[model samples]
Target: MPSLITPVMPPGSLNASAQPTLTIDDLLVRPWLGSDAAAVARVFQEPMIQYWHLRKADSEDEAREWIEQWRLGWESESACHWAVVNADDDRLLGRVSLQSIIMVGGQAEISYWTAPESRGKGVCSRAVARVSSWALNEAGFNRIELSHSTTNIASCRIAEKTGFALEGTRRRALLHADGWHDMHLHARIGEA
Candidate 1:
């Protein structure tokens, strides 16, 4: 089947040598590396991460596969995933992704997670804000959407802190291990 999604950036804009590395406060958002598998597996073991993301990498090999999938997403122009790391020590904090991109419509969905050790430090919030700005101003997207299970109060706070306005709720929109969840939608749009 022909692909429906178009590239967010023009051809050659995201070549290997030109991939972006965004710095936000003390965080560095960059492409994932093979050496990050161990840290990725460790983060996946966190209960909150497992609960929301609903996937885990039990071994470094599995984590590598996950990284490979993100790489493929970039190649296919379907998504852009960044490893959120501490700029001071280059420690992996978590991940933030722009997925469900509709280049023709200049829209995409943002998703993110915080590492167990990085929680409560505002890492995710800063990362989201920086990325959202880049998506709007640099990536040329007009609107970015975020959604979280209504039970995820922490995520709701991050969305609000990052300037995403509350949109509405979708009944039974997501199926987690605990069953269907009501999802709250939020969005950030570019200036007129």
Candidate 2:
């Protein structure tokens, strides 16, 4: 039953230590805190966020549960979510995550959302770049993918800015509230 290539990264590579707190200028990309529940809820209420991300927190409790799931994701190696906060004020600015992680394959999919006021200020892209670099160079991931609705021009720009090359378009790949939408798949491969 074990006649195959070795796992690119063994289990516990991520859970063996504390989730890293990454920094870029005034921004701190750290693990989600329970106190961030309210801020997380508020951001999900944004029309654009809901339209694209396809979920709303609805309440602080629900947000807390989501935060807990992200915490558990670190141990499970299924996902990693970081809350992007301003170092000076500790205000929530955005989120970046690696979803559908596969340690044996050393791969994951990147997802992100920025608060309304933080948009157009370079926060999301900077955080994404930092996190993606960490995942590729530090965390032993061999490839990280980013996909967005084809119509999401802003997301397309962010993916390109973070060095994720356009792979291809997946027809009707994702289902949002409106309907099924074609998605553009972008990816960055790492030496690890």
Candidate 3:
């Protein structure tokens, strides 16, 4: 798929005061669950997710705990974590979430991971666009933010494609095992 660019949304349609139904390329976006640990986990193991997240996580139990923790955030109303499942097969294809909500400003950050077999196919781009459009038009979110390491070009492409403008870079914001890495910051706001 071609890289995405910033697209102007309808005026007044994308605001923190409204919420739209978001549909991502026939993939149902639903809340994450412990039951989805196994399916959700397959994406975690992908070379891309592993590199971005910077963890190997060799066992299913370990991955389940991680999901459980994310689930806690959901339970506490601290985030919106979701599992992306194929509409036809209902098989979990990956996950996308609005995490670490900055409630004071009516903004939040989004994170997503796609199945290894599903990468380079525009699934991430579609999901981000679909959810971001909903977040702006229906959910009343003011801004959606994203950050990725410099080396992760694929993710950068995703952000750019989804209409998020690259703001700047956070110097050595992430301390990975290999070393510290910079985070490229990107953001998208409602149509003005």
Among these predictions, the greatest TM-score belongs to 2
Error of 1 at 79 (Å): 0.5
TM-score of each: 0.91, 0.98, 0.81
Which lDDT tens digits does candidate 2 get at residues 1-192?
883898888989899999999989999999999999999999998999999987888999999999999999998989999999999999999999999999999999999999999999999999999999999999989999999999999999999998999999999999999999999999999973
All models: lDDT? Answer: 0.88, 0.95, 0.74
Error of 3 at 82 (Å): 0.8
Q: Put the candidates in lDDT order, highest first.
A: 2, 1, 3
CA error at residue 55 for candidate 1, angstroms: 1.2
Kindly list the per-residue Cα lDDT of model 1 for residues 48-144, writing each as its tens digit: 8999987888899999999999877777667889999999998999899999977666788999998998999989999999899998998788899
Residue 104 CA displacement from its true place in model 3, Å: 1.3
The parts of candidate 3 lying over 4 Å away from their true place are 1-22
Regarding lDDT, does 1 or 2 come out ahead? 2
Candidate 3's TM-score reads 0.81
Which candidate number would show the highest lDDT if scored against the true structure?
2
**49: Cα error in model 3, Å:** 2.1
Error of 1 at 35 (Å): 0.7
Return the lDDT, model 1, position 136: 95
